[model samples]
Target: MAEEEKRASPEPPLPSPPESSSQPEHPPPETSTPPATFDPSRMIGIIKRKALIKDLAAAYHVECLALCRELLELQKRKDEPFLDTKATEDLRKETLRSSSKRAKKKR
Candidate 1:
């Protein structure tokens, strides 16, 4: 039985950079926010403000919906004549006839 010995291959080196940039190889340190301290008064004030904003928003929403409905109704009315065309025409003719009769009677 013949024993064969395997040669270990060498890994290629990384490409060299053209210029040394100002940037560091490692990323900049993360900015950390200050730890929050529990304040009952501040929390209560925030909750109250949030509730007030919600109430105001709801009121405005209702008002906006009302305005939208009014606008839609007005638009629909605009599409329809205030006095129907046939009725108005008949009324105008009747008025003219009545006026002519009154003028004849005055004569």
Candidate 2:
């Protein structure tokens, strides 16, 4: 009966896989060259294109600032009265002088 019970039991499960290490097994050498597919001229062209875009953006910013200043000045002028106090004073003096001259002529 013991021999028959042993034969009927299933085999034990396989052992669990080995625990993985946090670090890589082998690191690449530091002195390795870039891949042959990489082209230096292509990188240079990309850098020049970026510089051109930056320069154009800066020029656009300057032009926008200048236009904003011009618009602000125009708005300020529009807010001002048609005739300033100084000009009104001069006009009043001219009118008084003309009226005095007319009175003198009538007398």
Candidate 3:
């Protein structure tokens, strides 16, 4: 325990700067770069556009699921509906393949 404590202890502090050194008495004051002009209308437009895109994407997914559900319902009613099981399996495989690639690495 004593050996571990010694090992964990920090090193000595560094020496302070000397006062004898004759540095500049008064260096010129630093000038700040001006801030960019604000546009309230433009900012509002950008926010609205982003929200619209999000809503559109959500609506698209909902529509796709609704369509798929309708097709399933139709198939259930008909004995021999024209639904391609192979295409469904292929889509599943493709989705899994892409997901596996993403899973191997952290974003």
Candidate 4:
């Protein structure tokens, strides 16, 4: 009966030790050199392509900024009314003269 009671109430499992914070849980990846198949010319080509793309993107950005400034200036001009009566009179006179010439031509 005593042996049966001891078997029934077994000792609790031992607690595991806490992990050390000083060491990382996973090992660092190993650094490796480029493969023997690597070609220096191919690497240079890729670098040149990247530089060309960067330059093109910069130029495109500058062009867009310039266009935006021009559009804004145009909008400002459009908002203002042209107050040149002399220019308007000249245009009107030219139109009349052209119409008279056209009428003469029709004759």
The candidate that wins on TM-score is 1
Best-performing candidate as measured by lDDT = 2
Instruction: Kindly list the per-residue Cα lDDT of model 2 for residues 1-107, writing each as its tens digit.
Output: 99999999999999998868976789767777766797899999999999999999999999999999999999879766654766888999999998887555554
Off by over 4 Å in 3: 1-40, 79-107
Q: Residue 9's C-alpha lDDT in candidate 4?
A: 100
TM-score to native of every candidate shown: 0.44, 0.42, 0.33, 0.39
What are the per-residue Cα lDDT tens digits for candidate 1 across 1-107?
Answer: 12333334455788897766887888877779667899899999999999999999999999999999999999879867855786889999999998887555554
In the predicted model 4, the residue pairs found to clash are none
**What lDDT does each candidate get?**
0.84, 0.88, 0.85, 0.87
Please give, for residues 1-107, the per-residue lDDT of candidate 4 as tens digits: 99899899968999999889999989997679655697899999999999999999999999999999999999878765554665788899999998887555453
Reference-based lDDT, residue 67, model 2: 100
Positional deviation of 51 in candidate 3, in angstroms?
0.2
* Candidates in order: C-alpha RMSD to true structure: 12.1, 15.2, 25.6, 17.1
Better candidate number, 2 or 3, judged by lDDT: 2
Candidate 3 lDDT tens digits, 1-107 = 99999999998888987766576778767778666689899899999999999999999999999999999988776734334665788899999999887666658
Q: Give the TM-score of candidate 3.
A: 0.33
